[model samples]
Each structure stands twice: as structure tokens, then as C-alpha cells.
Target: EIEAVAASNRVEVKPIVMCRVTQVYETGACVYVYYGVNFFGVDDPLQLFFSIEQACVEVMLRHGAALSHHHGIGKHRKKWLPHVISTPSLRMIQGIKHAIDPTNVFATNNIIDT
Candidate 1:
């Protein structure tokens, strides 16, 4: 999927390292896939990253992969959070935040809204 996206966008996928593993803990089953790509002669770094991430996300969703593997939800990826986290779960998170940081002193645009 990464290769396909790179080809379609005329970008390069130079993965310096690739790793895949699955483990089951008391919490749940987890799948980890990590890779690093080298973008060659990139003119627009922002657009390139967004395009590649979007493509990878779509492919992952199609293949039943979680929206995020290690990275937590942030501003840029908040749009996709709804696809992964349920409404009740989000509300619960917000509630927990409020309980701990009632003033929202540590809140940022990237963190989930209350």
C-alpha cells in the first residue's frame, strides 16, 4: 500500500527500516508496523506528508487497521478520530480531562476538545 501510494503520487518510498509484529496482552491484541521513508527531492514537505498519510490511512482502514498505531490523536489527525473512537468514548475522555484539569490549563488545539 505504501509503495502504491508513492508510485501514484510520483514520490519515493525509501524505507530505511521496516518492522511488523503482533502481540496479545491482557488489555487486547495489538499489531505494530513501523517504517521510515525517504522523500526524494521534495518541494512541498507539508503536502507530501499529508498525501502519504492520507493514502496510508485509507489503505489501513480498508484492511481493518486501527487509525493510529502508536501516535495518539492530535490536531491534524483529529478529523479521523471520530472514525476510530466512539461518541461515548470521546465524551468519557473529555470528562476525564475535565476532572483532572478542570481549568483546561494544559489544553491545546491539538488535544481533544471538551
Candidate 2:
């Protein structure tokens, strides 16, 4: 599904599966996908990367996959946090961030806006 999404956007990706990092459960399994995109002849490579990544994330979410696993959600994925976490939960996280770093000194804009 992720590969299809990337291809639909005219992006070519080489996906490598990290089997050792995969987690298995009775209900389902979580596999880590490490992919490299070919940006040859692209004008705005960064924008293209973001577009493919966002589309892949949406596909994962639609298929009942978590927003993130061991890897934390950084600024790149913060915009979609609300879709995975509840409103109150997001508020609690923001409040915690405000409490710890009132001036937004630590990892500014890494996760939540606060």
C-alpha cells in the first residue's frame, strides 16, 4: 500500500524491510519499512518527499496501523498527531511540554507546537 501510494505520486522508492525490528502479536504484526526515494530531476525534492510520506502515513492509518511505533513523531509528523490521539490527550501533552519548557527551549517545534 505504501509503495503504491508513493508510485501514484510519481516517486520511486526502494523499500528495505528490517525483519529483526519487526514486532508480532496475536492480532497483527508491525514491520519497519526503511525506504530510499529517488529524486532525480525533481525541482522541489523536499516537497515531493513530504507529499509521499504524508500519503503513506494516511494509508497506514486507514489500515489500522499506529501513527508511530518505537520511532517518535517529530515535526514532520506532528500535523497528524490529532488524528491518532484524542483531543484531551493532545492537550495533556501540550500542557506537559509547557510545564517543562515554558520558553520552548528544548527541541523546539519537534513534536507539538508548544
Local distance difference test, each candidate: 0.67, 0.73
In model 2, what is the error at residue 1, expressed in angstroms? 5.4
Instruction: Extract clashing residue pairs from model 2.
Output: none
lDDT of 1 by residue, 13-108 (tens): 554436565776786656665655567766676676787778777776777667655676567777777677788998898788778888777745
Q: Write the per-residue lDDT of candidate 2 for residues 1-114, one digit (tens) a residue.
A: 545645655665553333344778898777765666676655677876787688778877797778677777877888888888899998998889888998999979875565
Cα RMSD of all models vs. native, in order, equals 3.2, 3.1
Q: Which candidate is the best by TM-score?
A: 2
Where model 2 places Cα greater than 4 Å from the true spot, the runs are 1-21, 25-28
Using all chains and alpha carbons, the TM-scores for the candidates as numbered come to: 0.68, 0.74
What does candidate 2 score on TM?
Answer: 0.74
Q: How far in Å is the alpha carbon of 72 misplaced in model 2?
A: 1.1
